[model samples]
Structure formats: structure tokens, C-alpha cells
Target: MSLRSGSFPRTFHASLQLLLTRRFGTFWLASLLSNIGTWAQQVAQPWLMLSLGASPWLLGLDTFALGGPGLLLTLLGGVLADRADRRRLIATLQSIQMLCPLLIVGLLLHGSIQPWIIVALSLVVGVTDALSMPSFQTIVSTLVDRRQLPTGIALNTTQFNLSRILGPSLAGVLMASIGAVGAFAVSAASYLPFIAVALWILPRATVQAVAPAEGGRDGPPLAGARAVLAQPALRGAVLTVLGGSLLCSPLLTFCPVLVKTVFQADVAQFSLTVSAFGAGGLLGGLLLMAVDPARDRRPLASWAASGFAAVVLLSALNPWAWALPLLFVAGGLAMTMANASANAWLQSQAPAAIRGQTVSLFMLAMRGGTALGGLLTGLTVSAWGVREALALNGLLALLALAGVRRGWLAVPRPTLAG
Candidate 1:
């Protein structure tokens, strides 16, 4: 149950090499640039809703629009990833993703920025994102050595968390000074470097060749999904994601509401709070880079999920100065540790023949869980209020994930060797 075990310097050096090397480095550059814009848009999107006097339910619907399509499409996308050229498929998706924000910009400029338009545009982006999700994860594994996956995924999370620090903070400033239109423009422009890399810089050949599946029954998406769900290990990983996406993630979804209603803060304070979560996630990602989740993923994951639930519950109770740090820790435990470890652990147990399908299920589960949970959480907020909703999700996740501690602790873990 150990994919990698090593010292701090070993992990650090691997990270440096992954960033400095050719293909992975290029991927890193494009990801960094694009995520900055994405994060900026993330901030602007909710703010836009509020400016239009949207309700908390509508705000939650925005997330649903963005992630809902993945529930149905990502598994198919995963099957396609296994069958087709992932690089080309991703490049096509990138083109589609690029066009989405440009349309949003036009809406912003023309003063026709209706909520439906926002929701539709977000749906397009989300569809592309969900369809390409497994390819994106698989692409990273191809970039580094197989053994370095733990480090690679951790570093990837670190990059995103770092962008959380930089991008939202920048978006807050830009929104304060220039307005949300500029934020959309920045997001539109951010797609260029990634398109360039996907078009030319990434290797022409598909990264790896897999042997044919043992059974010819793998033809259908349903069949592949069934194979995925039948595996006990994958089931556990999916549950971890469900806990994070459903229980813990509503904290971020409800951030704008918290800032506006509870804290009575403006744009800058909102930005600072966003950055706090990112900063905490960044630290957590770095810590994950050093350790091996394969060693004791079950317990670690259970604890992270439970810890995140507790933190979210606490933050909801006391929206004070300390809430910021609590949210930061929540991001780490809920997001970085939970997701990165799940991805790594799932990949370890997944067979190469159905790797794409497995990762797709993972992607779909994560995204689907988030969308459903966001919708439920939004309704909870609408009916009961944020504190009650937060407490409910927290208590439910805690009871579900950590309640049967001995049972989960006794569950078998994936091996180090893939």
C-alpha cells in the first residue's frame, strides 16, 4: 500500500524536474496561465449574479449548470478518451472552451448579460470541462514517470491552489477597478497559451498504448461504468470524492453569500477570503507531495473528509475573523488531500485496459457529486439558512464517512505497484 516513500528533498527535486522538463513543463505553463483566468472568472461569475439581484438558489444553479452535464457526458467522454486520441480531443475541447468566455464577454459588453445567458455559457464550458476531465488527468500521468504520479498530481493541485491565491486576488482588484467585463476578457485571453501547447507543443503521438480489454463486452459506456462501479477500491475512492464534493465543497459555493450577508464585506475582503482558501490548499498540496497516500489512504481520506466537514460546520457557526483560516484548512483537507489522493489511489487500482473509463467515472462522480450537492445545499440555504445547511451537510458527511471507522479501517487498500 505504498506508491512512493521517500525523503523531502526527493519529493522537492521531482517537483522541480516536472516543472522544468519539456512536455510536463509546457503543460504546467499553459495550465498556470489558463487557471489564472479561470479563477478570475470564477470570482466574477457569482459577483455578476449578485449584481443582478440573484437569489441564493440561482447562485447555486450556476454551479449546477457548470457541472451538471458531466454527470451524463463524462463517462462517455472517458470511453472516447480510451478509444481516440486524447490530445486532439482535448485540443478540440480547448477551442470550444475558449469560445465560451468570448461569448460571455460580448454579453457583458452589450448589456444583455441575462442570467440565462450566463447559465447557458457556463453549461457549455462545463460540458467541455467534464468531457475533457479524464483526458486532462491522464495527460498528466503521461507527462511524468509512472512512479512520480503522486508528486505530479500533488504539484498539479499546488498549481491550482497557487492560482487561487493569485487569480482571485487579481480578479478582485480588477473587478474593483475595471469591473467584471475585464475579468471575462482576461479569462478569454488566458486560453491562448493552452491552445498553443495543445496544438503544437504536446507530442503528436498518444502518450501510451494499452492492450485490448480482456472482454469484448467493454463496448458500451454503461458496461464500462458497470465495470468501474463493481470494483470495491474504486467505490471507496468515489465515496471520498462524494464526501468532499457534497459536504465540504458547499463552503466555497456559499462564499459569496457569506461575505455579503454574514461578514458584510466588499470585493477586497471577498478576494482575501478566496486567497486564504487557496493558500491553505497550496500548503496542503505541498504536504501531499512529500507523503505517499498509497500508504494509508483510507484513514487519511476519512480524516480529511471528517476534518473538512467539522471545519465547515464550525465556520458556519462563527463567521468571525478566525473563519478565514478555518476555511483555508477546509480547502486543504477537503480539496487537496481528498482529491489528489483519491485520484492517485484510484489510478493505482485501475487496470490499464479500462484506465480511461475508470478515470472518467472518477471525474463524473466528483463533478456529479458537486453539482447535486450544490443544488441541495442551495435549497437548504433557501429553506433553512446557511448555518443550518452547512451543519446538515457536515453532520451527514461525518456520519457517512467516519461513522463506521473500524469497518473502513479494515477495508483493503490499493498497492504501490501499478
Candidate 2:
């Protein structure tokens, strides 16, 4: 990782070019604002639940409810992305998600926003998000050429990570000043401009379903999954991500539990931990943006998994004073790098025919698997406590990742479609 000798300036220039593209620039700006609002709301959720006296299991269940619908619908979304009008679909989905926050605002103001209500709202957001994300990711291919697609994805990750950088801290400020109601309002307002941008820009990020490998057929969405699994590289990436999600990704789900129970931190102090994690992840995204796609991404991804899992295992040893920094080190840098690398690697390597489905599977590994993991981790936290649950599972996952590290390296890169 010696900075590739002379890669920074080129990467920086490429990223800037992507932002300057008329269609992508509009989408990116809108997405940035919307994502910031989304993250701010996310930061408030667990804290809000904490105030409602949410148990560990209840917290995990809430996350599962939010993510589970996507588990079922995202593959379908991938199908829609390939076969439908992506711009309209995205706009429609965005509009649907936008309502969740606005509706919740009234509930919050009325002091009737219970944990169950939060869970219900999360389901709505998750379903729409599941449907929209595959289309969203594949749109990068259309917005930029093949040469800049990976950079564009990295930039996309940067926007998300940037939300992490700004959203939680903003949530902290709003929560401190105006309470959760204000924080939720900001999130609700974020969607308007994002929808407006899509309606205005109408970017050409959609494509026809052309998976010639399936004999140039137009079958069900499962066909796309089969096509992706047929590739060893893509398969390996998906599996590794599944493990990461099932083991390490649930850290956020339980963050409230950890911060409140172990660290004795309030909402503002808890936001600091989130802010630290975001700062690290933002830096990590920048580093991954500079990674050369010409390199074999598998081996590096394996190394990152090993490192990330190890950190999770160690960080599970909860000494509150140092836990925040530990999380920044582990959750922030290692996990972020691993996640971004996996995404760029997969997107760069996937054939145009199966890109939508391929991206959806990645989404599944992220949201779906993490949802399941979050639930299990919550139950574990309830029974064994956060420290034991995290340590045991983190160790098991680390060992599993260590054993399979070389298998990922063994997966040969498929020939890219020009």
C-alpha cells in the first residue's frame, strides 16, 4: 500500500471529474444531503429507544425489522433495476421513504412514538431502501464510463461515509438543543431535495437486462444471482461480506447498549463514539478510492477481513475509556477499508449483464445478514451481556475469516467486459 507511487493526484482528479459530471453531480449533492439526514436520524434512534427503556433484544429486533424486508425485496429490486425505469423507480422509492420520517415527526411531537412505532417506521424505510439501492449503485456505471466506474463507486462510498462524519455529530447537536423531535425533522426534510434532484436530473443510470450467460434469456431475478455465483471472484466477495455482517456489522445495533450500560455515556457522549467511527471510516474511504483496480482485490480484502475481525474481538474487551478510540481504529478504518474494497472490487469485476443483481447480493450481505446478526447479537447481549457476546462471536468469526483468507485469494479474476 505504498500510495502506488503517483496515484493520489490522478485519483483526486478523477473523483473531481465525477462530481463535476452534470447528472452525477446533481445526484451526489442531493444524496449527500439526504444521507446526512438519514444518518442523523439513525444516531437518534437507539438513543430514543434507550429513553423508552428498550432492552437489548428489543433493540436487535428493531434493527432486524428494518433490514429484513430488504432481505426479501432487494433481489427483486435488482431485477427491477435491470428491467425497469431506474430513475422513476428511485424517485418513487425515495418518495415512499421520505414519508416515514414526516409521519414519525408527528408521533414524536405527540410523545406517542413508541418503540413499536419506531420498528414499524424502520420497516417502511428498509423496504424502500432495499428497492432503491441496487438501482442506485448500478446507476454509477451509466453516470461514468467503465474507466471511472470504480472511482465513482468509491466516491459514492465517500458520500455515505461523509454522512457518517457529519450526521451523527449533527444529531448530537440537535438532540442536545432541540431533542429527538428536531433531529427527526432534519432527517425528514433531507428527502425533499433528493427527490427533486432525481426528478430534475433524470440521470441515465438505467440499463436493459442482458445476461447472455443465461443463454440471453429473460428469466426471474434468481437468474442474476446464479450468474453472479458462477463467478468465483464475486462469490468469494459475497461470502466474506456475509461473515463480516453476521459477526462484526452488528456493532452499531448494540452501540447504544454498550455506551449506556458499559460506558455510562449519555446521548451526547455516545454521539462522540459514533463521530469517531465516522471520522475513521471517512479516511478509510479516501484510502480505498486510491486503490488501483488493476491489483488483485481479493488478497487485500482477505487481509482486511483478518485485521478487522481481530480488532472486533479485541475491542469486545470493554474498557470504556479506550473503547471509543478502539472502535475508531477497528470499526472506522479496518472495517471501512474492507467494505469499500469489497464493493469496488465486486463492481469493477462484475459483467454488465449481472451488475444489478450482483450489487443486490452485496446489499443482502450487508443489510440482511447484518440484520440477522444484529438480532442474534442482541439476544446474546441479553443473555450473556455485550462483552461476552461480542468477544465469543468476534473470535469465532476471526478464526473463520483467517481460515478462508487464502480461498478468496485463490479465486481467479474474471475477464472484464470492455
Candidate 3:
């Protein structure tokens, strides 16, 4: 389960060491701040919707708005990432994203915000993210040494999870004190540093040149799907994550509904539950950071997803005062382990020529599945109730686990050229 090489650094601080060795640290810092801002907004945005008396369906629709565009536009985004200057492309898209929260802040301050307006802005941010995320994912490889790639990725996940822990807690306080306007304003400001780093700090050559695609380097956008499908390990990673996102991710997406409706909790308790999940994820990412790069992560991801499913099922059965938050922490850990492993495995196995496109497929699976799952689960919750909806998700995850155990979802031990 651990990387077994004496040549590579085997210490827990391998990822942390990378911070002092190169500019990847710079990008990571900027990205962490931006992500924190985003998470804060996420907390406030949902609470804002509930305050407007929106239904569970609307809550789910909000999540869908935040991720739905990836289903249609992410492939093109991947293509653009490989074909054009990644830095400029990502910065441009991020600029567009920054505007969404800014507009929300304006509406909030003007006292004229509605549920549809918030959802509409989320859709805009989601569209920009779908286009830019492939490039953003691909750019990490360019920021560090290839041998240190796994650690670099782990660090990236760590920062994101860390933000998840911090953002919700911060929002809880901000929402109580200065309200949603303050949270939205902070999200707007966080994007500036990242944009500056992308445009002014990172070298142009690092983000500008990409490996040419096959057949005169002008293959269709769907070419990445073909490339991924051709490899067993790659295919398994994508499918595993797809199933994980589709069945289990909704539990986290709809946590507010679970808290407010089922437990009748207030904002502080809701934020506490979210922070617990983030804490577990932080631990998972840190665990990955210490592992060797050569370890095959396929089985790890599969097992984690299975564990996550079991936790989701347990959440439905437990009505104890302390149970749900603890389960959420476990869910967060398992989910992060599954996702980060699949992501690192895919990035390592995929060829350089189509890395962006391949990553886009990963994004499509992760984000697209979440969007659809949120919508479907929302409707299920409306019809059956939160407990039944979550129980169904857990059962579905176990079914996916059955497929993995039966060799239906295989990941052959192999590596590929970059």
C-alpha cells in the first residue's frame, strides 16, 4: 500500500517539501485562498436559498446549476486547454467566474436577490469552471518535477480540503455577523491573487506548449474518451469515480437539507457538520502525501468508495445526537481517498498529448455525475424523505462495489508513457 523506493523521499512532508523547492508552492497558496473563498460562498449560498424558502428540489437544482455545464462544455474546455495557451485561457475563465460572486454581492447589498438570481449566477460560475478546470488540473503537472507529481497533486487536494474545513466555519461566523453579503464579497476578492499568479508569475512556456494530439494534432474533442477507454486502469478509475459521484456524493451536496429538515439544526450545527467532512478529507489528503508515487491507487480508490457507501447507509440508520457529524467525517475521508487516488492515477497513466482531454473526462464524470445525482436525489428526497433517499444511495454504491468485486470494473497493473 506504500511506495517502496529508497531513492524517492518517503517522508510525510514530501508534499510540504515541494513547497520550498519550486513555484508550485506559489500556485498552491493562491489556489488555496481562492478555494476557501469559494467554499465560504457555497455555505452562504445554500443558506441564502433556504432563507428564501426554497424547497429541497431547489437546493438540488442549485447544486446542479453549479456543476451541470460540465456535462456539455468540459470536453471543449479540455480541447482548448491543449490547443491554446492554458494560462490565458484559465485566467480569462476565472475572471468570468469572479464576476458571478461579485454580481451576487451587488444584488445582496441592493436588497433585491431572489432564488432564481442566485441559481443563475451559480450556472454562470459553473460554466466558466467547466471550461477552465481541465486547464487548471493540467497546469499542476507543469508546476513541478515529474517525480514529485504525486506529492504535488496530494498537496493540491490538501489545500482544497483544508479550505473546505475553514470556509464553512468562516461562513458560519460571517453569516451570523455580517450576513451573506460579507461572505459573497470575500469570495469575489479571493480570485484576484490566483489570476495574478497565472498571468504574471508562472512562465509562459510552461503553460503555452502542450504535446500535439494524434493525427496532425487536430483530433476531435471526444478523442480523449477513446484514449481513456483503451486503457483498463484509466477506464476503471473513471468508472469508479463516476459511480462514487453519482451514488454517494449527493449525501454531501444535500447535507444542509439533512441538517435543517431532518435534525432541525441551526447554521452553526450545519457548518459544524460540513467542517467535520472537510477535516476527514484533510486527513486523507495528508495520508496520500506521504505515500510513494509508484503505488497503484486503483484498488485504494475502489475500496474507499465501498467504505464510503457503507458510511452513507449508516447515516440513514443513525438518529443519535452525535452520529451524523461523525458519519459525515468518515464519508469525507472515504470520498477524498477515492477521488484523489483516481485523479493521481489517471494523471500519471494518461499520455501528455491528451492530458487535458483526459482530465476533462475525469471532471465530466465527477462534476457531471454530481449534478445529475443532486437533481435525482433531490426529487427522491421530496418524494420519500431524506432517510430513504440516502439509504437508496448507499444501496446503489454497494451495487457498484459488487461490479468491482466481480471483475466487471477492472484495473490491470500497468503504466503508460506521458
Candidate 4:
């Protein structure tokens, strides 16, 4: 955690060098802008739903709709990532995703928008995103050398976290000035740059055919899942992430419900709360960039999970508007660090042939747990208030942590890999 360490400068320099490269740099910028747009839509959509008199359950259902498809399709997406042209695959899927926000914009302008309509459109976006994300996640390996892959991923995470900050903040301004319609419009426009980059800016990131793994290129979609579970380190990381997503992630999903119902707050407060989490996530990404690339990330991930659980507990027990942002900051930092460390380790360890499938499994644990958590939490919130619901969720996360700790702790320490 010390920035004064001698190796920090070299690690930081390495990270910077990777980011400055043309292929990765262009993709990073595009992804950042697109993520910002996505986050803006995230903020606007939930607020719009709340404004339409949606209940906590409906809000949760909307989040589930946006993430649920990953459970069913993410592994298949991985197969496509490994066997298909990743660049074209991402470009095409994202173009489809872009339509979801545009549809919302059109519906809103026409006064025909409803909460269910938003949920339905979210399901559409989720499906495309589920299929595209594995390819997108694996693209970093193609852009940067294997040695620098961890740093590249850390930088990639940095852009996403940065968008988390800027996007919600931008949404706040736009919503205050022109309403959710403006936010939705910006979200739609954000996809264009990334689509352009995938199609043209990075040629090597594209691949026409992939070498088969242990199985043929056309092997079963769940083959990757089996291989991942067979490895102690991979299995542990995925399971930990499942608990993290199921318990901690819903806090972000239901932020509007918490602010409006618990604090009697407005969009500005909601934006600030989400932005605080994003700021912490950005810091976590930066910290990861400076970590020694050769170090074992498993311990770091475990400690982060523990810290994240504590923060979740604090948020529920404290439950004050003034303290919410600080708790959220800590929560975001810990969770981002945990997830990113696990991600870097997975990408580094998995073989090239199954890399896409491996990443898809990670996405499944993350997105699927988040989706299910949102739905369950929504039901809980409807029955007992947000505070009580979060308290229970936090406790459950701690218990789940205890159950999964052995899998990660038993992982053999890793050496530097190229």
C-alpha cells in the first residue's frame, strides 16, 4: 500500500508505457467514453424508473433484466470470442446495444416510456452485452504483450472506473439541466467511438480463426467452465466474485431506492453517491497499476473481500446521508481491487485457447450474481426497508466469505509468467 517503495516508480512507468501504445491507447479511450455513456444511462434510467412511481422491487427487476442474460449466454460468448473475429464481434454486438439507449430516448420524447418498457430494453442490452463482453475482455491480451497484460488490464479497469466517476457526474449535470432524455442521448452517442475503434483502429485485436484447445474449436460451451473449476485458483476467484456480486453489487443497483426512500433525496444526491463509489474504484485501479506485476494477487483479493464486507456492514449500520459517500468509497475501492486482482490472475493463468471461455465464466459469476442479488434484494427491500435488507445482505456475504476462503487460500503461490 506504500507509494514510497522503490519499485513503485518502475511499475508506474511500465503501466504508463503500456497505456501510451497506439493500439491499446485508442481502444482505452474509446472504451472509456463508451463506459461513461453507459454509466450515464445507468444513472438516468433508474432515476426515470423511480420518477415513474416504480417500487423497489421493480427497480431491482430492471437491474436483473440488464444482467440476467449473462447467466445463460456468457459462456457461449466466450466460445465466440475464441473462435470468431473478436473485433467484428464486439463492433456488431455493441452496435446492437447502442440501440437500447436510443430506443429509450425515442420513447421518452414521445411520452410513451414506462418502467416495464425500460426493463424490456435493458434485457435487450444485457443480451448483447453478455455476448460481446468476453470478446471485449480478451481483446487486451491481443493489444499488449503477455508480460504487460496485467498492467494493461489494470489500466483498462482504470478507464472503466474513471467513467464511473465522470459518467454519473455528467449525468447529474445533464439531468439537472435537460432531464434524463439528455442523459440517454449522451449514452447512445458514447457507443460510436468504441465501435469505430473495434472496426478500424486496432487491426491486430481482430482475429479470424483460433487454434483449438484440448478440445476442438467447436467444443461444448461449458468446457471452459469445467476447466476453470478444475483449477483451485480459478475456482476460488470465481466463487469469491459470485458472493461479492450477489451481496455488495446490489448496493449500487438500488442506490436510487435508498436515496429516494431512505434519505428523501433527489438526483443530485444519487449522483454524488454513485460518483463517490466510482472515485474509489478509480483509486483502486490506479493502485493495481502500481502493484508489482509478478506478485501473487490471491492474498490481495482475499483481504479486499474482507474489507469490502466490512464496508457493506458499515453502510447498513450507519445509514446516514453524510456518511454514505465515504462508506461507498471504501466499498468501491475494496470491491474493485478484489474483482480486478482476480481478473488479472485469471487472464494470466488461463491458456490462450480457452482464455475467452475463462473470462466468460468470470463474467457469469459477476453479472449473474449481481442480477440475482438485485432481484432478491429488491424483494427484501419491499418487505423490510433498505437498511434492514442491507444489514442482512452484509451478514450473508460474511458467511459466504467464510465458506469460500479455503478455495482461494489453498491456491499455490504464483510466479512471474510471460
Candidate 5:
């Protein structure tokens, strides 16, 4: 079967059904709840900064606070994943994640809230995420049979996009009905079910044996980082992740600014824009889930890249406010499909022992790229203007596509079931 043609054999549905029937369904529900809270906080935090009289530089700094730690800490977390129990690590990190929102809530309740406080709390959340993400990616294989790994990844992206739909709209409503503090409190409360879910999951049988360090070296965490950076495929994956992040991740950060400054719309309009984007992302996720990775990887990646660049360029044209929903549709589909495809490919190609490290590298590239993109966009908005800055972003995205076409990045063929 030609992967580019999009036809799948019978085995695809059978494997997908087996995956959906297991504990994976329960896990997906829990993840959805937790992800909603995370997304709510993501929307609230930037708004909080804006309310506190922050400048564009300060706003960019806020983005850095939320993503910079992943660049600094994910590699170390990956090394730990190779050496420890991933489930336990995730549980502990989730517990730490709970503290971030609670801290924000306390500050809000006391009327001590400030931009710096939001920045500090965002740093804490980023730290926990850096530690948690790698282990989380590595653990999915343990939750389901290998044949269903792609399905599991697609479903995970689907749930996250679902949360993207729920979180921003809910945050807007909560902020209007109560206040930012109330939104933070709800976000804190959402963490409890995830904690419960983490504890309740039955431990799976260990699949891969841990290998000792080479030459019994017992060196620092940097050794594993060096090893991963040395591999050509891993390096390409990391760069691809960076490219995707630069093109896509800034939408969430800039949406409020776009709604407020460019559209001259209120909070409700902002919420609708976010929801529309999430709806598009949800559609992309479902479309990806329905397809067979072995038969769809290459063309999906190519299509997603080109589509993302095109949508970004079109969005930059500054269409009428009535066209916001269409913009969201384009942005959402481009973001989710491109990201999910890259993630699936990365996870499949990574060696079992270094899977966590490899994933961490990917996460680092993403976070780093987002941080840089947010900063640059903020500056460009202050200087050239929003439309021009967005156009520049689209141009950069097109450049990334050229890189992919030139073989600077390669998506590997998906493995088939026996």
C-alpha cells in the first residue's frame, strides 16, 4: 500500500479498537480534565500580566518564564527517566504542578497579585512541565500494546485539543463571573482528579530493560545529552520540532493581543477565537486518528507543513473581524496536525533506553522556539506592526518547509503490525 495515497488495510481498525478498549480510555478522560486546567492557566496568566501594566518586553519575559525552564531542565529529566520509574516521576511532578495554581490563588485572594508574581508562578509551572513531559511521553508505550502506539498518540493530541476548546472559554466565563482569582482556583481544583488518576492506574509489566552507562562511566547528566545531540536523526527531529513551534505555538500567546488591539473586540470575542482554534485542532486530531500512520506519515507531514505556512500567511492578511473563525480553523488544523505528526515520528524512531531523552530534546526545541518566537513577535508588533510581524512569521514558516523539502529534516516510515 502506498502511504501517500491514504488507504489503510484491515489491521489498522483492529489495532485501534484494541487500544481504545483498554485502560487507555480512562487515562484519556483524566488527561482531558487535567489539560483543560492547564490551558485555562495558560490563557489567564498572560491576561494577568497585561492587567498588571506590563510592557511588550515584560510580556515576552512572561512567555520566557513559562517556557524557558523546559530548555534548561528537560534533558536532565530525560536522563532520570532512563534510570527511574516513569510513573512515579510523573505522579510526583503532577503533585508539584498543583502547587503552581494554588500559589497564584493565594496571591490573588490576598490582593497581593502582581505581574512579577505571575511570572514567578509561571516559572514554577514550567519547571514541573520540564520534568514531567519526557516521562509522560515515554510511559505511553507501557499503557498500550506497541501496535496501538500511534493511536494512543493521536488520541492524546485529541484530548489536549479538546481541553484547548474548553479551557479558554471557561476561563473567560469564570473571569467575568467571578474574577481571575476564581479562574486560578478552578484551575487548582482541576489538578486533584489527575492526581487521583495517576495513583489509581495499575502498574504495567516492564518491557525494556535498563541498560547501564557505557564503559560503566557513571558520568554526569550531560553525557546523555551529548549522546542524543550526536545522532543525526535526533538532531533533525529536534530542529523540525523547533520549526513547528516557531510557526504554531505563538498563536495562543498572541491571540489576546490580536483580539484586543487589532480586532478591537472584547473578552467574549477572544474566547470565541480560542474556541474556534481548538475546534479546528480537534478536527485535525480526529482526522489523524482515523488514518494509519504506516500509510500516512510522509504525506501528512508534508501537507501539514504546507498548510500551516499557507494559513499563517492568509491570517497575516488581516481579514475582517468576521473572518476570525476561519483564521482559527486554519491555525488550529495547521498546529495540531504538524505537531502530532512530528511527535509520532520522533517517538517511533527513538531508541527505547533514550526515548525519554530524545523526547525531552524535542520538547526543549519546541519550548525554546516558542520563547524566541513570542519575543520576536512582540518586538515586531511594537515596531513594524502586527500584520507585518505575522507576515514575517508566515515567511519563516515557509522557509521551514523549504528546509523539510531539502532533506534537512526527514520523517521516518511508520512500523507495521505483524
Candidate 6:
């Protein structure tokens, strides 16, 4: 009878069945497919760039292209998300994303693919992602009820992590066989299902029209950002998350290099590293789902952050090829706990009216921190070597742990309604 007890309500089930009976399920499935394709392209594009004689600097540049725009544009996108119909905005952005891969494929097919083109296209994708991501978060409110929100978010992340596993593995095979362009083609086609699902869905049910702001000027654009930052708990969580992301996000980009240079492995080996990280993330998500931290998330987040730091440090010292499985576990747990905690905290604190903008600020911190970390790590690895680069990341994690200990990064207690 209890939703948390793993027993579904008959009414809820019936509602779900009805929702899935038409366009809702189709859209979710299509979104999943599109996401997987996007992940595939993410892995393949970087690999393709490296193959074309890109240096570490260029690799960092590529990461910048992918994340920098989000940092710059997400606030604006968040404003737009609050003002627009989220579903329509997402559909339009996704349609643009569909064209990105097509252009990449065309260039590849014509034998004119280059590192600059890859960088340019990656920037375009990043821009589209920046525009769509806020709407995507806001649209989730329409897909399910308040009680189901946490589960829905968890499932969505689970799907993303699953793609993190499948995409790289599939890309490795496809790259080895039909080449990177073939991988790009698959990513291109992934958008069609999502587009179709969007078309099939009843616009009336899913597209909630946002009312215009009451204030004449809509207040300051930065009002939301400033309000969120003013909350000590929220600010702490955001800071801790930024630190963790700086340390964690680079693993995806730099792991390939670590595999090739440090382990002397091939593309499959690189893909396997990514799979390990994803597997760990998947495990972490399952663990979080099993635990109830509503009473107190601060300690949980602090412990997770501390544990993550220790794990990364240990992984850095790990010798032997067998150390990889451990790295996978570390990667998974670190990402799952840290991200879910921050998201849950933000979601809990944010008012529905500005929820999209709040989430955008959170995302900006995430993507911006990640891009900065990747760039810094690339530079560090070039100068100090992989082990040292990883060690530096571990040090950042330790610094975050200190923040938690000093009460500088406390989680906000949710205000309960009577």
C-alpha cells in the first residue's frame, strides 16, 4: 500500500498505465534513447579528436566547448524556462540537437572531419544542452506527482548512468568496426524516437503554461541566484558539490588518457574504465534509493564527500591492472551520493515558481566546475603526470571534507508544512 514499501497503489498503477497507454511512456522511452545516443557521441567525439592528433590542450579546449557555454548561458535559459512552456522549449531544443549529429556525420562522410570541426560542433551541442536542460528539469514537474518526484529523478539518473555504461561500450565496438563516424550516425538517429514521442504526447496535459511575473520588471534576473546563494545550507551544498565535481568529472575525460598512457591499453580498455565508473554510479544510486535520509541529509552528504576523497586517494596509489575495479566502485559511489544529495537538497529548498532557475544555478555550478576541473587536470597531468593529477583531485576532495567539518557546508533542514 505504501509507495516507499515497493507496493504500488492500484490507483497510481492505473494512472501510470493510462499515462503510458498513450504518449507519456513513449516520450520517456524516446528521451532515454536520445540520452544514450548523446552519451555515445560524448565518448566518441573526444576519442575522435584525440585520434586526429589533438593534444591535451586541445582536449581541454573540447571540454570547455562542451561545458563553458552552460556556465554562461544557463541562467538566461533558466529565466526562459520559467517564462515559457517547458515541453515546447525542450522539443525545439531537441530538434536542434538532432541536426548537430547530422552535420557531424555529413562532415565525416565527406572525409573532411577535423579537430576544429569537432570542437565547433561540440560547442553547438553544449549550447543546445544549455537551453534545454532547465526546461527538462521544469518539465519533470508535469510528468508525475510530488510524492513520485524523488523516485522519478532517481530513475532518470539511473537511465543516464545506464547510458554512461552502454554508450561507451557500444561506441568502442562501433568505432573499432564501422569507425567513429558510424558511431556519430547512431547518435544522430537516436533523436528520432524522442521527437516522435514528443509529437505523440497530448500537449494539453504535459505543457503547463507559466503565468507572467507579477512585478513590472520581473525583478532582477540575478534575484533568484542571489536568494539561493544567501541560504547558508544551499550555499554550502553548492560549494561542496562544486569541489566534488571538479575532482570527479575529470575522470571521464582524463581516464581515457590514463588508460592509454599509464596502462598502455587500447580503446576497449578506455571504454572499460568508463563502464567501471558508470557501474559504480549505478550501485551508488541503488544504495541511496535504499536509504532514508530525509531526517538528516547533511551528515550523509559530508560522509559521502569524505569517503569519496579517501577512495580517490586510494585509487591513485593503487598499482596493478586489477586496481581498476576498485576505481569503478569509487567513481560510482562518489558521483551517485554527491550528486543525488545536492539535487535533493536543492529541490527541497526551491520554491516551485523559481525551481527551474534554481536548478539552472545548480547545473551551472556543476558544469562550470567540471569544465574547470578537466582543464586543470589536463594541465596537471601534462606537467606532473596522471598519478599526481589524480592525487591533486584527491586533495580537492579533502579540502571539501574540511568544509563539511567546519560547518561551513551544512545542509539546510526542510521546513515542514503543518
Best by TM-score: 4
* Top-lDDT candidate index: 4
* Candidate RMSDs in order: 2.8, 2.0, 2.3, 2.0, 3.4, 4.0
For candidate 1, give the lDDT of residue 73: 92
Give all candidates' CA lDDT scores.
0.76, 0.79, 0.83, 0.86, 0.72, 0.70
**Clashing pairs counted in every model:** 0, 0, 0, 0, 0, 2
**What's the lDDT of the predicted structure labeled candidate 4?**
0.86
lDDT of 3 by residue, 1-418 (tens): 5645753355665567787755777888888899889989988888899998998899999889988999999888887776777778878899999998999999888899999998898899889999999989987877766676777888899999999999999999999998999889989999999998888654564433433344114666567667776777677788888888888989887888888888888888888998899998998888888777777787788898888999989987788746888998898889998899889888887767777877888999899989989989999999999889999999988998668645634446645545
Q: Judged by lDDT relative to the true structure, which candidate is superior, 4 or 6? A: 4
Candidate 3, after superposition: displacement of residue 149 in Å?
1.5
Which candidate, 1 or 5, has the higher lDDT?
Answer: 1
Give the C-alpha lDDT of model 6: 0.70
Ten residues in sequence with the least summed lDDT for candidate 1: 209-218
Off by over 4 Å in 3: 3-9, 205-216, 408-411
lDDT, candidate 1, at 237 = 73
For candidate 5, write residues 1-418 as lDDT tens digits: 1424434435446545744665777777888898888777777777777778886666777787778888789887777666666667777888887888898889888888889877787788788888878777766665765556667788888888999899988989988788787668778888888777666673533224543442012445555555666655445556666876776566666777777778888777877888888889998887777677554454466457667777767777866887877888777887788777777766666556666676778778778778777877778777877677777888887887667655634534323111
lDDT for model 3 comes to: 0.83
- Candidate 5: lDDT over CA atoms? 0.72
What would the per-residue lDDT of candidate 4 be over residues 59-114, giving only the tens digit for each residue?
99998999999999998988888777787888888999899899989998999999
Query: Candidate 3 at 296: error in angstroms?
Result: 0.6
TM-score of 4: 0.96
After superposition, the stretches of candidate 5 with alpha carbons farther than 4 Å from their true spots are 1-19, 202-208, 212-234, 408-418
Candidate 5, after superposition: displacement of residue 176 in Å? Answer: 2.0
